[model samples]
Target: MINGISYYPEGRKYTYFLKSEEYKQILDRLEINYENIRLYFSHSISFESKNILEIYLRKCVLDDTLDLFNFFEPILQECFEPETNQYKFEQIVDLVIIEKASNI
Candidate 1:
């Protein structure tokens, strides 16, 4: 397993978390494929407020999870803005984590 976990077993093989602008950039890079699109909006509030995009890919384009992370890292680092601060962002993330886990 990679990163002390089995990504396949976790059912996260096709799931991705990305910033909206970064997501747009990637989409532009692959301009031909626009017919397949799904967007799940995450609205969160805590000491800080934030937003997130959970994108369910229709196909496997990236080679591996590491590649996915690397692809998203630059985008995330360059533009991760919350309506509030870090603490609130964490709270929202926690809520998302819990909701996602419960759904499984």
Candidate 2:
């Protein structure tokens, strides 16, 4: 059985950026249709790397359930892969916590 909380759950301010060739290709499209990538997850998510990415998640996701490597997973464009019969995944961007001494 579990005893109690283990780690800090408070979410800190952060900045987000979208990467990948796919993301770059659709940048113009995203501007025209803002909801194409992240509709409700975060209205502020965009090409601007300096924007606060964790702002929206702060309200909903605390670090309570997190472990050494566990962290909030941001949403990205879903790409279907027929070859592997699975969805394609890749590193979209890097995130930096505003208050943290350094990002993990």
41-69 per-residue lDDT for model 2 (tens digits): 21324323222434433443443343322
Worst 10 residues of 1 by lDDT: 89-98
Question: 45 in model 1: Cα distance from truth in Å?
Answer: 12
The residue-by-residue lDDT of candidate 1 on 1-104, one tens digit each, is 01111223343445564644565566556553333234434433232222222221112233344444344444334334455532211212111111122222
Weakest 10 consecutive residues, lDDT, candidate 2? 1-10
CA shift of 65, model 2, Å? 8.1
The models' CA-based lDDT, in order, is 0.33, 0.33
**What lDDT score is found at residue 38 in candidate 2?**
24
